[model samples]
Target: MVQEIDKLTDNVNDIKSLFRTLNETLESIEKRLSRLEKMDSIEHRVEVNQIDLSDIKESLQRIEETHSNEIQHINRRLDSHLVKIAKIEEEMIIIKSR
Candidate 1:
C-alpha cells in the first residue's frame, strides 16, 4: 500500500508539470495574437495614408496646370503690348524724318 501511494504521488507531480507547460504555451500564443492585431492596425493606417497622399498629389498637379495656363496667357499679353510699342516707335520715326 505504501508503494501504491508513492506511485500516485508521482503521477500527481507529473500532471502538475504538464499543466504548467500548457499554461506557458497558452500565454505565449496570446502574446503573439496581440502583436498580430497591432500589426494589422498599423497596416491599415499605412493604406489610408497612401490614399491621402495620392489625393494631395492630384491636387498639386491641378494647381501646377492652372499656373502654367496663367503664365501662358500673361506671355501672350506681353507680346501684344511689345508689338504695339514697336509700331508706335516706327510711326514717330517716320514723322520726325518728314
Candidate 2:
C-alpha cells in the first residue's frame, strides 16, 4: 500500500510540473502577441501620417498655382495701363507743339 501511495505521489508531482511548463509557455506567447499588436498599431499610424502629408502637399501645389496665375494676370493689366499712358503722353506732346 505504501508503494502504491508513493507511485501516486510521483504521478501528481509530474502532472504539476507539466502544468507549470504550460503556464510559462502561455505567458511567453501572450507577451509576444502584445508586442506584435503594438507594432501593428504603429505601422498603421505611420501609413495614415503619410497619407495626410500627401494631401497637404497637393493642397500647397494648388495654392502655388493659383498665386502664380494671379501674378500673371496682374502683370498683364499693368502692361495695358502702361501702353495707354504712353499713348496719352504722345498725344500731349503733339498738342503742345501745336
Candidate 3:
C-alpha cells in the first residue's frame, strides 16, 4: 500500500507539470494573438491611406489637364491678337508713306 501511494503521488506530480506546460503554451498563444491584432490594425490603416493617395493623384491629374487646356487656349488667342496688331502696323506704314 505504501508503494501504491508513492506511485499515485508521482502521477499527481506529473499531471501538475503537464498543467503548468499547458498554461505556459496558452499564455504564449495569447501574446501572439495580441501582436497579430495590432498588425491587422496597421495593415487596415495602410489600405485606407493607399486609397486616399490614389484619390489625390487622380484629382491632381484632372487639375493639370484642365490647366493645360486653358493655357493652350490662351496661347492661341494671344497669337491671333499679335497677328492683328502686325496688320494694323503695316497699314499705318502704308498710309504714312503715301
Which regions of candidate 2 are displaced past 4 Å? Answer: none
lDDT of 1: 0.98
Compared with the true structure, the alpha-carbon lDDT of candidate 3 equals 0.99
How should the candidates be ordered by lDDT, best one leading? 3, 2, 1
Q: lDDT of candidate 2?
A: 0.99
Q: Whose TM-score is higher: candidate 2's or candidate 3's?
A: 2
Model 3 lDDT tens row, 2-93: 99999999999999999999999999999999999999999999999999999999999999999999999999999999999999999999
At residue 10, candidate 1 shows an lDDT of 100
- Candidate 2 local lDDT, 1-98, one digit each (tens): 99999999999999999999999999999999999999999999999999999999999999999999999999999999999999999999999999
lDDT of each: 0.98, 0.99, 0.99
Ranking by TM-score: 2, 3, 1
Better of 1 and 2 by TM-score: 2
Consecutive 10-residue window with the lowest summed lDDT within model 1? 39-48
